[model samples]
Target: MASATFRATDAEIANPERGMYVWAADDLAAWTQAQADAQFAAGYRIVYTPVRLDRYAGEALPRKQLDALNESFATARRAGLKLIPRFIYNYPGGETGYQAAQDAPLERVLGHIGQLTPVLKENADVIAYLQAGFVGAWGEWHTSSNNLTLPAARTRIRDALLAALPADRFLQLRYPPYLMAWALQAPRWRDGSGASRIGVHNDCFLASSTDVGTYSEDAATRRRERDYVAALSAVAPFGGETCNPADAVDPTPRGDCDDILREGRQFGLTYLNDTYYRKLFHTRWEAQGCLADVKRLMGYRFELKALRHSPAVAAGQSGDLTLTLRNSGWARAFNPRGVHMLLKHRFTGAVVRITVASIDPRSWLPGTTSESSARFAVPAGTLTGAYDVLLALPDGAGSLAGDVRYSVRPANADDAVRAQGWDGMLGAFRTGTTLNVL
Candidate 1:
């Protein structure tokens, strides 16, 4: 049992693989057979979210995608697993004929929710939410959304949803700063209407348009998820960073579990999954294909409340720089389970020196995010090339992420040069350094 009085329900744990990346399937049988074989070999259950009809098929609620997805659901159930049929809406392409009818009454939205719920109810696992700013999220690779302009329509749709969804059904609003603000002032529904489970999911790990790429947790994405959770939580109870699964990535994975776990707990989110579209293929060797890396990121976000650390550095120095760390995660090291934060350096190809910390593989659960510090001394003879600090966390009673770098040549850090390095040939392989766990 979770320590919290308001822990997540059984539905949230539909399947607990820690991370998920998906493959497309014109035929569900083919995907199921392939995935089953892979899962057995991986020694882990794989979380596969089928492509919603809103994507590739052009059917906002296309029967075919649903049918194909149902097949996958059937397979998952048989294998003792779960499948979330992702439904992305409000995108220009997803603008169904029915949307125009929503209007102030939101009748169209209600009818649509009403229409789809029944089709999915029998497959209770099909229970899920919507992508509020669906097509507009750069995180989703369909970033042309600013041009697509989902706009304020999400509120209306959300209103209709209040009356349509069941008590436990959830809907994730993609990066809606505006909605977050509005949600703060208003509840998900007017009260007597039905309870709507709402939250935020971001493509923090995603990097490209139709590309399965991602970036490490920076201040902005953190701010967004934090803000969204802050806002959405006012109306609902949970939220999370919908990260992508990664195998190989630059800057490596780091300090994210702090944010991930922080937001999960703070926002009432006990369960987390990737954006339905934020994924790379197992065969994909691109920097975006960080499934292995993303694995280190599952289930760590608790509830981050603006706890930030500032480094005391000036020039290129070998001194230990300490930044203020916070307990934004769900659990503390003192708990039955402990969460630990690690820092590492991307030293050479296929090699990363686990400089400051290591992965504590033994503890971690689906709803634990602990707070800790990241301290590392610049190597005595470190040169002036480029370097990064990584943070690794995971899902457990304690923490489940691994070593993540936090800084490089701290004292000499430059705004312009660092800016150049920012979004640079990112998604590329950095030097290989391995951090042996403690």
Candidate 2:
């Protein structure tokens, strides 16, 4: 009849598929395992790599280039880091502005996507989500020398990318209107269709009144667009980076802690670019005393508030365990993951695992507390002994199911939880309580 309560930690967690992500070198091949290790050591679990295809705009990607791309995924897998990959043709600016930025024609773009589909599917384990790129300047989908910005062109590109990516994965566009134009249904994508999997990534976050044209300038239109993005973000991933304050439309000196936190919560912001406009925004947040908060609350910070379980149970009998958790982050996990309950024998090292099928971590929204219960049955052959209780939220990909680096850890205070409570080898959190099997 004993229950244990756990305290939450304010420290930042380097959980998989979320938080501030640094940019890798332009060449995916240049993303070495050493670089991944360093980033993970620096408390980063995600890396953003822009795959440049400007040279192959008129033709198919060479075998060497494709091999390099595959190598990047391998590196990520070895280092236990996920990637936010974007395939773009050109950056903004030349003799002309974005208008002169030369992206591939519609046919060529689709061809490139078709070529990249296999790589994407093969590496979906390491890919957090694919950004909708390969159009306009800097892959923001604005200007296109090939008229890829036209309504029909955009539709074709969107559909092609969605088709290319794994159905479980999401594709994030640069603007809100792109999603609104296509997804007329509700925000939640339970149907697993292409439209349901589409989300928004605002590259120009907090840069202006409308985030540098991410939303409409018209009052009525802007309201509707923001509403759509907010609703969509509840179920899909929503993230981006801060643009230069100089580019702000109002230019009233944004990036204050209050405004940043307000908008972050409003849009359910998840991952953000840690490299871009750092001095203007990140540094300011640090000085203003909200940088750590932003880092800790970006994606999904689950805290174990309490645990209830039977102190002892007979072999072959079932015992109920319940957990009270709070998602203190700005957004929930958009991708699917596995929830499990484990009983590790203290003496023999034998483990018993039960999949908690009733709970989905993705549905654990920010600023909300949820209680999930599961029943675990002891094997008839189990030895009568004390067994440690553990909880695991691991990646859904079969390839990553055993990797602790891809698992979710509760943001519980180190002092309140057992020392080394997070078992790297088992990829589970020790509940600081043991069960006796009679």
Candidate 3:
């Protein structure tokens, strides 16, 4: 029989690697900091920035622009936030559509990615994912003056960007057909193991039957694309925004929250734009009192079902710890995060962390439970006292490893734990269960 030490019920609170995103460029310093801080305070951890390359379609991004972009990344890092970055050549013209005047040549777009590779690589830690955005207005890859949709140009651009990014970072395409075509040509994409590291994003999600052309107009093609997106999201990140309610042509659904939940689970969505058409969401769902559910289920909400271990241990001793966790959110964590068990002094607050190398939290899919066990080594010390065992999910990267801003909190309704701020991190929850070290 196992001796359980800690148990918890699921609760709603903001975690990391998922949430509503702030839409703006990182280089917009004044707007970036204010938005990032406000969003962070409100329990959001992701920001979507469209890095406009429209101004210099014919030339390299100016030095000033590059510096500004780097500064924006630094700001996000400081604020302990992640950004979903897209590089676009043109903004959508409200009525005219497809303003080709500012569109960059295919070659220029590829060159720009190569030039920006250094910055992207340097700050890859803060990027949630890169949306392939060099073509088309609003970077949706349609109605473009440039013929980037042509197979050859598209392939070359995709290859260049893929080569520029590190293997870990994911890139998102606008359409599923585009990726399906590419997959047919490359066996890696067909492997369905996320080797291609590419996924799709639906900007005008759930607007119309065709979702504003996110999928094919034909019924069969739409089904195929939907399946493709579902398959891709099993291992890759997939998400987007709800389109403006006023523009939705579909009358039957009428922003049904149930439909949203159904499709969200079906598609394995990892994130969404919270601000766009948000008023409609508030008006429709808030009064009905289901918006809180939507917020909790958006990305990955992990709960600790049970934790068991030896109730007592000698100083410098090694012992076994086991944890059973359930993922209640809509999707899995699409990025890497560290899982460690912390042994903290009750009085002095000194801590010793044992990282579990065998457990990868990214594989914790929704509606599923998983068990993990690992041996923890307690440090040799002179003082013998009771210790608080805490669980920490911090960024694996060394720079952010010590920053509690990057640590993830569990969705348990323990106000004492929530208020106690885990390990020196202010406003950060470090989940705990008690243990004694003699």
Q: Each model's TM-score?
A: 0.41, 0.94, 0.89
Write the number of the candidate with greater lDDT, choosing between 1 and 2: 2
Candidate 3 residue pairs that clash: none
Tens-digit lDDT string for candidate 2 (184-239): 65456556667678788988788777887888889899988988888888878898
lDDT of 1 by residue, 1-438 (tens): 001111111111112322343432433335655675455345333343434323332224556645765666666544533333444332233424333311112343344456565555555442334333223322232343233324455555555544454444545555445444454443543253333355545444222221123222455754554554555444443323443334234423322334334444454442343334233322242243434333433333222211222232222332232222322223222111222222233354222333344223222223444343444444334333333432222222111122111111000111342221111122111111122212
> Which candidate number would show the highest lDDT if scored against the true structure?
2
- Which residue window of length 10 is worst by lDDT in model 2? 413-422
Off by over 4 Å in 2: 93-97, 313-317, 416-420
Q: Which window of 10 residues has the lowest lDDT sum in candidate 3?
A: 185-194
Candidate 3, residues 236-256, lDDT tens digits: the string is 778888776344444233366
Evaluate residue 45 in candidate 3 and report its C-alpha lDDT on the 0 to 100 scale.
86
**Candidate 2 at 89: error in angstroms?**
0.8
Measured by TM-score, the strongest candidate is 2
Candidate 1, residue 280: how far the Cα is off, in Å? 14
